[model samples]
Target: MIDLRSDTVTRPSAEMRRVMFEAPVGDDVWGDDPSVTHLEHYLAERTGKAAALFLPSGTQSNLVALLSHCQRGDEYLVDQQAHTYRLEGGGAAVLGGIQPQPLDGLNTGELPLAKLKAAIKPVDPHFARTRLLTLENTFHGQVLDADHVAQTTALAREQGLATHLDGARIGNAAAASGSSLEALCAPFDTVSICCSKGLGAPMGSVLVGPEAFIATATRWRKVVGGGLRQVGSMAAACEYALDHHLPQLIQDHEKAERLAAGLAAIDGITVTAQATNMVFVAFEDSAFAPEPLHAWLAEQGILVGALYAPRFVTHRDVSMADIDQVVAAFRDYFQRLTR
Candidate 1:
């Protein structure tokens, strides 16, 4: 099937598999994994953080960061649409005993400062103590600029709150915004970046922060059962992706724009603003619901994502040819509907 579901669906390339097979690994929990340590150091240097810890997944990385930053009964603020709150299965609340204060995320992927300020809890006994402000960059494929991130982090600092960034797709954000990864991560105290998503790694995420914070997060990672043995193979894949795949994301963005323009031309389709590699397409009429559209596409040997509204993503494996086939399918389906 020609999968346009998500960048996460892309399999590891041959180079990545080769590196993984040849990777030197040791017991990570014992702090003897040279390859894992190298991956952590590389990620820390890339983000300009003092230290880094490798985690099993982006969700675990974010959860461990939240657990490390906020105490039990503390509150953390994030956008209502953030993946941490919506997609991470309430790990913060369930495991960390923290409350999530959901705020509106601007179209640019930054939370409104005034709204964020109002969301903070006063030092009274009546409310849950607001301890941290979390932000997500490249939220749903839109890159939030550094100026906005700096402003929001400054706001959090003034309120005596720490900051964490859920930067799962931060590489895409940095590439799209023409910003250095270090510059993008400068404001937040900690950042969790994914390697398995658009970065094209098979598994793993790196959590970057001060040495002290990462030290504590490392302990929390173990408590959450995220400690892995011989994970250097996975780390090797991430290192390879960081070195090789990151540079190709811009091409994916270009392809997404090309696909979006073609979909926008269809008579019964509406493509939302395009940014990075995600495209949100809404059918003009409810007569063609996403379920039927998804099934029809499957019959045509295509795989599209089933989201709240129909969603399609461009990734490493999806080429211009794949985009053309998808567009042709859209045209054929619409023509048949009009008959």
Candidate 2:
């Protein structure tokens, strides 16, 4: 199937798979895996952070950051639609005892400085101590720029709050925004970047931050049962992806834009402005259910997502040929709906 569900669906490329198969393995939990250690150090250098910890998933990385940064009954502010707030199953609250204070949507991809300042507790005994401000770049591929990141982080700093970034698709955002990884990551105290999505690594993510912060996060990672043994294979795949796949992310973003434009041209369909590799297409007519359209596309060997709003994502696996097929499928579906 031509999967457009999410970049997380991508399989590792041939080169990545070869590296994984031939990787030198050792115990990572014991800090004896040379390749894993190398991957962590590589990510730290790339992000301009003092240290980094390789984690099983972005969720674990974010959760570990939250646990390390906040004590029980502490709160962190996040955008309402952020992945950590909406998608991470409330692990911050349930496991870390950290409460999430979601800010209302800010269209410009930044929280208003005044609103953020007001969200911070004013040394009150009755309130949950707000200790962290979590920011998400590309809230599902929207690509918030460095200026927005700088302004939001500046506000958080003024309120004495440390910042964490859920940078799952950070490479895509960096490619789209023309921002250096270091410059984009420098504002936040900690940032979790995924290797599996878009980058085509089979599995793994890295949490980067100051050496002191990462030391604490490592403790929390073990406490949360995230320690891995013989994970150098996965780390090797990430290294391969970084070297070979990261440079091609812009092509995926371009394909997403092309898909968005094609879908927008179809009657009764609305496509959001394309930024990275994700595109959200909505059927304007309430009666025009997405199920049949989705079914039709699947029958034509296109594996689209089943989201409530019907989201589509272009990934490393999808190509210009796949984009043409998707556009053709949309044309046929729209014509059928009209008839």
Candidate 3:
């Protein structure tokens, strides 16, 4: 089946597997795993950060970042729709006692500067002190504007707030905007780069930042049960992805553009948004219902994310031919409705 549900579904290639199999291993908690240590250092150098820590997942990376930045009673400002705020299971609040001040944001996934400035507590005992400002790049596959990021981070700095970036798909953002990873990540104090997404690693995310901040995140990671033993193989997979799969993100974006264009031409479909490997579409006209399209596509050996408003993701695992098959299936479904 051609899986368009998410980039996370991509499996490691034989070459990546071979690299993992040959990787040397040691206990990561003791900071002695060569593969894990190399992966962390590589990511840190690429992002121009002082240090990096490998974690099990992006959610843990973000949670550890928040824990490192904020104290028990402090809060962080984030967009309501951001994965760190909405989709990450409230780990920061549940585990770290951090409060989240979620604000409405633009369709671009940026929090309004005025609202952010207004949300900071005035050193009062009545409110949770806003300690950090968090943002997600490639928010729903859309790259955050560079200027917007600079301005937001500057605002946070001026307000005496630390900043963190949930850069799970920063590779896609960098590829789409022609920006270097260092340039893209420079504005934030800390960033979480997920290797399991479009990069095609089986699992892992590296959190990079200043040495002191990374020290704090490391402790938090251990406290949160992220201290894995002999994870050199998984770390090797992530390192391999950085070398081999990171460059392919551009092709994923191109495929999304083609898929969006194809679906937009169909009579009963509205192309809602397309960016950095993701294409979202809405079914138009009351004559056709989107509910059954899920099963229909499944029968055709195609898969998408949502049932009603579908989100089709293009990844290393999905070829251009698969994109054409998806477009043909949508065209056939709409044509049958009209007939």
Please tell me which predicted candidate would have the highest lDDT against the true structure. Answer: 3
lDDT of 3 at 314: 94
CA-lDDT, candidates in order: 0.90, 0.88, 0.93
- Writing each residue's lDDT as its tens digit, candidate 1 over 1-339 gives 789888999899998999999999999999989899999999899899999999999999999999999999899998999989999999999998899999977766688888999999888988889999988888888888777888889998988999999999988987798888899899999999999888899899999999999999999999999999998999999999988998889988998999999999999999977889989877778665676777888998899777456678888988899899999998998899899
What TM-score, computed on C-alpha atoms, does each candidate reach? Answer: 0.98, 0.97, 0.98
Order of the predicted models by TM-score, top scorer first: 3, 1, 2
Better of 2 and 3 by TM-score: 3
Residue range 1-79, candidate 3, lDDT tens digits:
9999999999999999999999999999999899999999999999999999999999999999999999999999999
Off by over 4 Å in 3: none
281: Cα error in model 2, Å: 1.4
Give the per-residue lDDT digits (tens) of candidate 2, residues 1-339. Answer: 899988999997777778898999999999999899999999899999999999999999999999999999999998887889889999999998899999986754578778888788877889999999998877778887677778888888877899999989888888888888898899999999999999999889999999999999999999999999999999999988887888899999999989998989988889855668988877788777677777898899999778467788899999899999989988997897669
Query: Where does candidate 1 have its weakest 10-residue lDDT segment?
Result: 284-293
Q: Give the Cα-based TM-score of candidate 2 against the true structure.
A: 0.97
Global CA lDDT computed for model 1: 0.90
Model 2 lowest lDDT segment of ten: 104-113
